[model samples]
Target chain A: MGSNDAVRKVHRHPERQRVDRDALYRLLDEELVGHLAMVVGGEPLIVPMAYARVADALLLHGSTGGGFALRAATEGHTVAFSVTALDGIVVARSLFDHSMNYRSAVVYGELETLGPAEEDAALIALSERLLPGRPSEVRANTRKELAATRVVRLPLADAVFKVRDAGPGEAEDDGEDHHVWAGVVPARRGWGAPVVSALTEPDAPLPPSVRRLIEVPG
Target chain B: MGSNDAVRKVHRHPERQRVDRDALYRLLDEELVGHLAMVVGGEPLIVPMAYARVADALLLHGSTGGGFALRAATEGHTVAFSVTALDGIVVARSLFDHSMNYRSAVVYGELETLGPAEEDAALIALSERLLPGRPSEVRANTRKELAATRVVRLPLADAVFKVRDAGPGEAEDDGEDHHVWAGVVPARRGWGAPVVSALTEPDAPLPPSVRRLIEVPG
Candidate 1:
């Protein structure tokens, strides 16, 4: 969480930089999908994967991440994971100053693959993050299934959290006409009605977790 | 758009791989921010950048992406960019089959700094993509501002696209309780009303582009 290093520098918009652990945790908790970035074959590669923030570490589903993230972990290479929530759009007086309202977090660390016990817990944690309060409603993972799933852990020690949530910052002395309106167009995300698939029983009741999911917005 | 390259493989979910140009084009055109991944100081780094698809190339705003992207362009290093639209979450009968419905794209290529004319056009294209018709509403960037902006271009080649759009795909004979209701929870993103800043004139009218953005959902 120190700021003296080159990796943590927010050079362009230093004012937007945040070093608190809460910022990073909130960002990871809010987004279920993160772009897991790694060096593959001497070139950069990225795969969008389902992830979870368990306490202070990140658990990545290697199968969903294309299995290369697991390989990177075994190879002892440092990987970077990034998540973002585009809050809104800032319409400025000029195109140069036009920007986006967003909260972005990038975590960099060497990954460690979890063993059987931790893997089961990590996969359940990932599922809970993706669909909260749903683990108790379904069956547990079989032994083969647990072995098939690859979960890697990355400590939350190194990360950068940046947020921009404000109105336009147009200079007062700028020569643009104030009559040209400028402000923000906020973004909102919500969950729609639960769609029952054909395989489900016609009279089967929806789980309590799903009812909560429909009622809440995340 | 060929799929014979190493970077274009979608191993785990081979059935979800898409080779059509429409799929790739639509994914790029829809999202404004992408995770730009590159190797910095022997470690993986990912930055969420505002990007636009112009013709057959991706134009990244270097200033918004941070100065390192421009430096990476000049250094002749390759980078990867990824974008995702989480359409919904599939609540399957079991935890193993539970997954997210998403459209993800990853583009791998080296970057090139744009010339003056191309930079101006690319900048306009970036803004136009982010806020559809708003480019025409705002004033042009000043000469000094143009000089300060670093716009890099990457051809839309050697990319991979994967999509999962169907409902829960639980097998008929998988031997789970039929009474466990399962389905999909759709995700929706919409723009709220614009908040006029204090600096704007009281009677200033909202631009048509802003109105169009609110009326149409992307």
Candidate 2:
């Protein structure tokens, strides 16, 4: 629940910054994808990657032959992974104070490429994270398939979470008219109908994991 | 309508790589936020920023005082700005092929801080992007408010766009079961009911911008 190093402290919005470890873990677990960024060729390069939180580390899915994440892992560069969720819109009387309610976290760490037993464990963890309770419903990955995928893990030792969940901010005697509309409009993400593939049998039932996800309201 | 240089080209999935300028412009215009990142102190630093596209450049909103983006602008670092939209989940027959249907773009370039007249225009563009028709319904920003904000612009010259909008991918003779249910689960984002501030009159009519945004279904 304490601060990381001085270099990664949240300075811009001190009020919104959170130092709790649970906040960091919760943010990582709730989001399915994140932006992984690193400097390459003297310019910043960032790409969205699918990730899963397993304990205190992040398992990033990377293709052995093509993924830039793999290159970052090979180079042992300190990478940044960012996850953000937009909560709502904060409407204010003045445009200057208009803001978005959101929760964001940025983690700074070096990615280590996993091998052998750890790689299989990371892949299984990633699968469960993406589709809970479905690992048993699926077949095991062939050796060739496993060999083509590279799993990289980043320890969650240095991260910062910032959240803005309240209503619009108004300054004291800001001189704006009182007869204006100001409030918040909540935003959310939801899953639509599960589309069965045309090739699959029409009567095949939906997987339990998929059923539970859509049945529960977001 | 052409590709960028080799260093910034999309080599991972050439089929998903889009060279059309309209596609790149549409993706940037549709998204309200992006992750701006650079290598600072030999570590990657990224922050989520509200941005808008005007012509061929991105205008990012940042605090002039404590924002890391402001520091990046002052340092003249070649920053990376990434925007991604997760359209849906492609539920394959096997977890090996499971993937997310998404459109992602990573732009490599430098951020230039806007000047007097351009700053005003950039601010307006950003406001319109975040909330359409909002500027007309709100009061103009004060001189001090304007001075405290910094708007950084990044050209869309060196960029790459990749999109996966299809259903599950199945390999020929991959030795997988035929009876498993597999398809795409569509995902969507929506806005909830607007909560009017308690301070405002209960019967205060909603602004035209707010009314239009929520009334229309996503």
Candidate 3:
């Protein structure tokens, strides 16, 4: 999938572009914040981070501070990460086709910097792709906290994804007024009850990796 | 709050940066999706948009198709626009302190482009900030759908606003194992159950602006 000239199709919905590499690893394994962009000083920054997807790359950790993912892994430059997710809102009865049922992706390369034994297996594959059965329930990284953390991998071979998840295209001689309540409102993203930390142990029990992330589901 | 040299403080927690103006209008009125970025040909593209926040600016609309927000509103360049939200995931106990309780902002300037009489009041303040009371319950834009849409805007004076809503910053002889389950997993973002439109009228009802967005409160 990394080949129709690898990424760059979808000049604004080129049929919701998706050169499927399993829909770019299912929108980089169901998004958890991404945005990274680059070119600092000559402006364009972006930021947001927190990423994961460890196998074909895309790791990104920080705190060796002076960050922009540690200066795009010490100036190898050329960045651009993205991710997105927002899957559902598209109410369309026209506010110029009110849309938003996203999935996004983006990628673009150059970021490597891992070493120190591949940043402790890219921080335990970014804590098992952000806490899925919690990297064997915590407690491991210590070489002085993996030499004060920095990670940075980025390589889903120049990605692109774009989905939209249907519903609301409205156009049967589209003259508006179909009694409007037009479909889709979805936009979910759950996991609420788990505020614990007063420094834990006030009956220390909710940890089957945080009760399987609030019984998973959203 | 556009001056401590206005917007360039958080280089990675320069103390959760935020130069206030009502915390950049409550993270651009509780975000809906932003990203945007620029520099097209020499790389860095980004995209995702769907923005809103009317008054001090930040609007963005598209469809005149040669995309990247109509080429960053026709090459008046300097783009950026971010917006994040994420609000919770912090499951720390170290995976190098697993973070993410975001609120982001970003903004860096130059987008203007709005005239079709201020693109119909920035598309009714982006359809009343994305369907909140569904732009007085639908049906309005028609001057050939406001001459095929494009909008733009951007200003909130070079914004910044980086928040990280606490819970999980542990340190007390920091050696791990204080009985696991470290806090925060919140990440809410609601609004589901609305499906309605197959062309509406299957006994058409659910409206009070989609029943006040499923009783709001996320």
Candidate 4:
């Protein structure tokens, strides 16, 4: 992937770290959630949350009444957010060589509140990201509902993206002699049979976005 | 799935949350990796890393060279660690009721370094926790390796164990028509085929512990 963005770096094994704009965009678009990490009193805390993408910024929405979210908004602190999917485990002969093959992104930035118009757009982006076509199916957010929720963006800057995909390497000692079972347990994602809400008609078809989900080896 | 030991009221669904001592111990044992959340400098951060459990305490293995581990060793600092598994998504009718069915333990306390004997015990326990019987197959840790790796343990106290599970609650307007998909995607765990070092014999049978893995539906 080409590194067209300022926040991304090739890092060591530039091949392993994708810095291209398209790759980064796809990574963000495919994942539905991220773990947001920040330093509180110098200790590390992580929160798993959902998110949406809009151009160069990623939108996060939460209740203004939430303790963590409120503290994050009021303090305006810099935070690190990561989205990772472990595809498989790479087990080698030596313990130290045992590692996981995964796609991960670490983004560092300060939270910025969305402006009046941007907030609405961000929510739409988030709704579409999570439910896809359902954003149009559900009733639009009322003025009161919008006022109660908080939306903010964390720009794509100071980020590191790393990935490793391949089978395990041969042991250093007698290469062919080490006979151990070796293969990958592929991770996958897919929607289960949809359940019609108790209030819905018995045979309402699944929405396009939910139905159109593509399975990727996790 | 009893409320006998649950820490959070909302997370104490009997059918969804589990409290078997053996099960909890096994959950912590079979898993070699987890997310560590800490409060440093009044901010929260989550670090995803490998971990090992030893007896009644959880040992966080790290290097003196790493910044986070290094700062943790300094006196007069407190750290809280949590391990969470998202078992399934509970898609309720109302947005306010939407939640995840998960198993998590939040540990609060100051971390302390293990003594020489405790370090040895910790490493063995960690090995067993990660690979079960493999501690016997692999060579024991050398004094140098033990000395090189730093092991810090947080006592089991000050921990809040929580979980949630069950189907969505019926909407108050149940007779009214609606169109929403709701169901569950059960999560399962077991040992994948183990990778033998390229140098191992091609037909070595896996140790009993690894081969006799317990598959649990979370």
The candidate scoring highest on DockQ is 1
Q: What shift in Å separates residue A136 of candidate 1 from its native position after superposition?
A: 1.5
Candidate 4 is graded, for docking, as: acceptable
Which pairs of residues clash in candidate 2, taking residues 3 or more apart in a chain or in different chains?
none
Among these predictions, the greatest lDDT belongs to 1
Runs with alpha carbons beyond 4 Å of true place in candidate 3: A1-31, A34-48, A51-60, A63-68, A72-87, A101-136, A150-175, A179-183, A190-207, B1-34, B38-73, B76-143, B146-148, B151-192, B195-218
Backbone clashes, each candidate = 0, 0, 0, 34
Model 2 CA RMSD to the hidden true structure, in angstroms: 3.0
Candidate 2 on A1-218: residue-level lDDT in tens? 22225546767668888878887788788778788877666556677888999888888885211375567445766777888888888888877778888888887778887877787777778878777776777787678778867888888887778888887776542866768888898986788899887777777889898898788665
Among all windows of 10 consecutive residues in model 4 chain B, the one with the lowest summed lDDT is B1-10
| Alpha carbon lDDT at A62, candidate 1 | 54
* Model 1 chain B poorest ten-residue lDDT run: B1-10
Q: All candidates' TM-scores?
A: 0.94, 0.93, 0.35, 0.72
Local lDDT at A50 for model 3: 72
Q: Top TM-score: which candidate number?
A: 1
Candidate 3 residue lDDT tens string, B1-218: 22223225655567776677887787778778888766655456676778788778888875212254455445666777788787778888777777777777788888878778888878888877877867777778889878867777888787767778888888742867777768888877787787876777776677787678778866
Per-residue lDDT of B56-151 in model 1, one digit per residue for the tens?
A: 888887533477556754577878888898889899877877889998988887788788988788888988988888889988877888998888
> Candidate 2, residues B1-218: lDDT per residue as tens digits?
22224446665767888788898888888777788877666566778888888988888886211375567445766777889887787777667788888888887777887788777777777788888998888877778878877888889887778888887787542866768888888877778889887667777788988888888765
- Which pairs in model 3 have colliding backbones? none
